[model samples]
Target chain A: MTVGLTHFLILGTILFSLGLYTVFAKRSAIAILMGIELMLNAVNVNLIAFNRYVAPESHIGQIFSVFVIVVAAAEVAVGLALVISIYRDRISTNVDDLDWLKW
Target chain B: MNFSLLSSEMLAAGLGTGLLILGLIAPKTENRRGFGYITAFGLLAVLVATFFQYGINQSTFHELWIVDDYSVFMKQVFIVAAILVVLSAVDFVETLPRFRGEFFALIVYALLGMMVMASANDLITIYVGLELMTITFFVLVAYQLGDGRSSEAGIKYLILGSVSSAVLLYGMSILYGLTGTTTIPEMLTKLTWSPILVVAIVMLIGGFGFKISLVPFHMWSPDIYEGAPTPITAFLAVASKAAGFAVMVRVFLLGLPLEGAVDWMLLISLLAGITMVIGNVVAIPQTNIKRMLAYSSVAQAGYMIAGLMSMDAPGVKGILFYSMIYVVANVGAFTVATLVRRALDTDTIADYAGLGQRQPLLASTLTICLLSLAGIPPLSGFVGKFYIFQAVMDKGILWPAFVGFVMSMISVYYYLNVALYMWRDDPKDDRPVPVPGPAKLVIVLSLVVTVVLGVYPGPLGELATMAAKSLF
Candidate 1:
């Protein structure tokens, strides 16, 4: 059986689901960051596959995917810096520890 | 490149970059008040420039950026919000342990994001503009690194915000796959009702729901509001949420096929109803003022969404007018809170005792702001609510409007409760609460606008109507 757009979409969906699960289940902030990265990668895959199969003439999808990669990188950098700052203050990277502002 | 068409955005970007560079070269001990003043004045100038471009309709760069009455009206609101934030923030920024000049510059960058988001005609531009704004907010929220709550709020906002953006992106990808274009109008032409399209739209709405803090997606707001600096909280509450609505109007009203296969309006009305109920009900129990306002802001968004669900010219006009009033009223309220927080180092409603006697001006200003937010007559919020309800009533969507009206009445209890604390309760410590000059100016200006607009809303109303007309 030859792989096609449907197969690529299936793989992308699975990766996205796993990433979302990791984000919700993981305690460590770094692990959650990894989850977010995974989700973004899934989106990138979807973008490229669509660009190749659906709209091969226009580079809009390709350009959008590139922009997504750049934005994701910036988001992770800011996320890590914030995590490190919180870690320095509380000495823990667990999500539970950052509950100072809870109702 | 038609430089004249893009002058306002260019001015904002140039000034923001200039401030960033100046912030680096300035000495550590230099007073940062000048930076705030420059930012406020520069933004005001840019706002004036935008007024000249208001009637000149143009779309450039592959139709990604459009200059029209709607964008111009929204840009004016954002510029005004930015000016108020910077002016009020001068005293607060001065009190930080380390005053970085980039604080002022970051605000300009965020304002630039909002301005771009207002005019974004393409999906790619919207995504980019939104990320630019949110990323700047991440830094601004954590600017006070010595404060633990600030850093915690920053991290929480970052994680949640990125997840939502990724979801929004996934939705955009699906849309692109189906339509094969990122341009909103082109995609609108090609859109057909498919299960996948519904999924994409739902995901997009869900993503925007997080930004505007409608009910289920609002878990992070109270924490972030209670933790982030007061001015930044005010920014997030007012300008950022307005941008979200701008995108919503652009995407849902203009881009999506509202009258076609899918009934997105009903879904939106459901969200609006739930949001109004939850936001008002939850606000009643909050003792912390920022947290309380966070819930109130949520409820406010619900009211605007109710107007948006009308999906007509009147509905869009109501949204525009309501957003303007909300910026003035809410910003004024937060300015008072900021002042009290500075004086007392607390944000509890109980601690606001005897504030009326101690600081008559601030107490009165806060009262006006809160009453306006509660939709009391003779204030801007009342007129705003009137417009919104009238629009919804026109569209024959009475349930949500009834919910909104009842919620506004319920909201009056908590809003006036703050006034009760200020006026009824006796002073614990009777030292007068001093109001700084700039902050006092911000409060007075916003209060005047609030009342002035309430009494004679014809000018802004006409502008809002004009702005609404541009969408179709």
Candidate 2:
């Protein structure tokens, strides 16, 4: 049996679910950022697989995935900066500690 | 491609870059207030440039960028928001420890992103523009380095906003896979009903829902609003939400159509109803003024979403009209709040006692703004609500409209509670609230627009109708 589009989509969905679970479960801000990166990577997988199989005539999906990769990198950079800033003040990156503005 | 078509965006980008260079070259002792004035005037130029392009309907970059009345109208809304924010933020920016130039420049960059969203004709363009705006806000939200709350708000926004963008991208990938295209107009013809399509639509809603701060996805807004600088909070409430609505309309109404695909209207209406009820109900008990406005803006988003039930020109028109007035009313309210925060250095509602006696201008402006938000008769907010509900009623959707009507009534209580504190209670301190010149101009300008638009919404109403027609 040959590998197919459905298989790739399943892998992508699994990665996405894992990432989302990480985001919800993780307490550390850095871990949450990692989870976001994983989710973005899952999207990249989906985009590439779709481009390879469905729209091979044009490279829009591949191009979109490239844009996603770049943006994900930028987002991570900003996230790390924020995490470092918060860590300097509170000495912790736990999201639960961010209750200064809560109702 | 006709470069002239992108004149406004180019101008905004140039202005942002110019400000950064100006900051570097200017003498260390020089005041940064000049940057604010330059940014405001530059945006005013961009706003005028959009007016010249208003009636044009064209697309470029292989139909990936569009120029039409719809985009022009939305661009004007964003530019007006940026201008008001910059004007009011001049004094606030001067108080920042450092990076004052970056504050104004980042706002312009965000405005540029919103303009791009207004004209984006492809999913990729939309995603890029959205990220540009969000990333800048991530920095802006955290700009107050000495304040832990500001930094906390920034990180939280970054994490949640990135996740939402990822979810939105996943949905876009599915859409491209199903349709084999990324262009919205191309996808329009290729779309067919499937279970996966429903998943994609839901993901899209969830993503945009977060951007507009719709209920359930709005968890980050109050924290962010309360922590960020007041002018930036106002900018988020007015310009960012409007940009989300603009793209949502383009994607759902124009691209997906949803005629034979799914009954997404039921889903949207359900969300809209809950958003109104929960937003207003939760807002009633908030002691902090910014947090209350954050929840109130969420409820306002629900009212705008109700207009989407009609899926027609009239509904779109109502949204545009309401967004315009929302910019005016919300900025007015936040400007007063900004002054109050600066004076008392506190955001608690009780701190505002007897503001009517101390500084009648600030108190009266805040009252009018809150009244407008509460939808009192003869105010622009009331007229805006009427248009939205009437559009939904015309569509024969009664429950969401009725829920909106009742929730807005519930909203009046909290809004008036703040008003009563200002007017009825004794002063905490006898010293007056200082009204800076630019902020005073913003207040009076917003007040006039709020009142005049309520009295005669004819011209703007017609313009909104025209913009709505162009979308179809």
Candidate 3:
């Protein structure tokens, strides 16, 4: 049996679902950032699988995955910076505690 | 690489870098107000350059970057927004404890991101441009590091905004997997009605929805608006939102097969209906003016989405016209808020009492701006809404348009309530509110544009029509 696109696609779907769950369910800000990273990696898997199995001739999929990696890196850097500063200010990194502005 | 076509972008990039370098060279004791002047003048030069390039359409770099009327018009809008924000933020920046030069530099960088976004013709460029804009915004939102409210707002925006971008990237990946291309026009060829495509489209909408603050995705905006500095809030409300709509229009109209899926229309219409209803309804109960404007901005985005439901050139034109009108009116309103926030050190609606008696010009300007936002006649918003509803009417889709019309009426009450508070009630302290010269110029400029375009909308209306037609 040979590995195929469907198998990779299914794997991507599961990873994406887990990421989505973590983002919505996590209370810690750091945990939320990890969830976002998880989601971006799922996208990378999808891109690589498509590039290998579907369009071997064009490198658009592979190229896009690299872009995603760079973006995710920048996002995490900023996210962690924000969380640390908020921690410094409030002594906690919990999402619930960040709610100073409410209706 | 046809360098001439990218002259405006290059100019912006150069200015941003120059400002950063200048900040390093300038003495630490120097008044940073000079940085603000440099940025404003640089933006004004870019605006004039963009205006001069009107009607010369071209595409370069394998058609991945476009230079058309639509992008040019959108570029002009972003430049105007940046100029207004920089001007209004001059005094406000002086009040901040640190990072004054970096603040102005980041603003110019963000403007460049918007310019690129407006011109992006491929998914990769769009993603990059959007991240460039959002990352700068995350910093801008959290610029007051010592302020807990600012840091919290920044974190909220960072988390939510990143999640939305991840979702959008997932959707884009799927679209790429299916189509083997990222260029929007080329992708249109491979698009078909498949379950995967359906999921992709849904994800795309969800991602863009968060950016435009359409109802469910709008949770962060009010908090961020209330927490971030008022100028940044105004920029987020006007330039950022406009950039989102511009990219949305490009992607949805050009990339997706709107004609293939009537379900997409239903989906967007539902979002629009709920967004307008909730945004306006929630705004009524808010006492904080910044948060109130946040909800009101959400509702305004809903009206623009309503225009998109028509899915025709006129509908797109309606969005274009309405977005321009919105930038002027909403920025005017926010500038007034900034001035009021500075004077009273409060944002409560009740505290605005006796404004009409004390600072008659600011109060009256804000009233006119709010009235314009409420879609009152002889104001630009009235004509803007009329165009959108007319386009929706042409589609024979009466319900969403009807919902929009009624919601506009509900919106009028709350908008006028602010006016009533200003004119009717007495102030606790009857001290005078000082209006600085630069901020006063911004207010008067926006006021003039609002009233002028409201009365004679032909030239701008024609330009919007052309821009909308170019996309199709």
**Which candidate tops lDDT?**
2
Every model's DockQ: 0.87, 0.88, 0.86
- Tens digits of lDDT, candidate 2, B14-123: 99999989889998788888888999999999998999997889999988899989999999999999999999999999888888878999999999999999999999
Residue-wise lDDT of candidate 1 within B45-104, one digit each (tens)?
A: 998898898678889998898988998998888889999999999989988877458889
Q: How do these models rank on DockQ, best leading? A: 2, 1, 3
Question: Could you list the CA RMSD of all candidates, in the order they appear?
Answer: 1.0, 0.9, 1.2
What is the total number of backbone clashes in candidate 1?
Answer: 0
What is candidate 3's lDDT per residue for B1-472, written digit by digit as tens? Answer: 7878889999999999999999999998987998988999999999989986777778889878998888998988888889999999988898888878989999998999999999999999999999999999999999986989998889989988999999999999999998888999998877877888888988999999988998888988999999999999999999999999999989988888865642577788889999999999999999999999999999999999999888889999999899899998988999999999999999999899999999988998899999999999899999999999999999898987788889999999999999999999887898779999889998998888888889999999999999888877
Global fold similarity of model 1 (TM-score): 0.99
Model 1 ranges off by over 4 Å: none
Once fitted onto the true fold, the runs of candidate 3 whose alpha carbons sit more than 4 angstroms away are none
User: Per-residue CA lDDT of candidate 1, range A18-100, in tens?
Assistant: 99999999999999999999999999999999999999998998899899999999999999999889989999999988878
**Which residue pairs in model 3 clash with each other?**
none
Any residue pairs clashing in model 1, and if so which? Answer: none
lDDT, candidate 1, at B146: 86
**lDDT, each prediction:** 0.91, 0.92, 0.91
Which residue ranges in model 2 land beyond 4 Å of their true spot? none
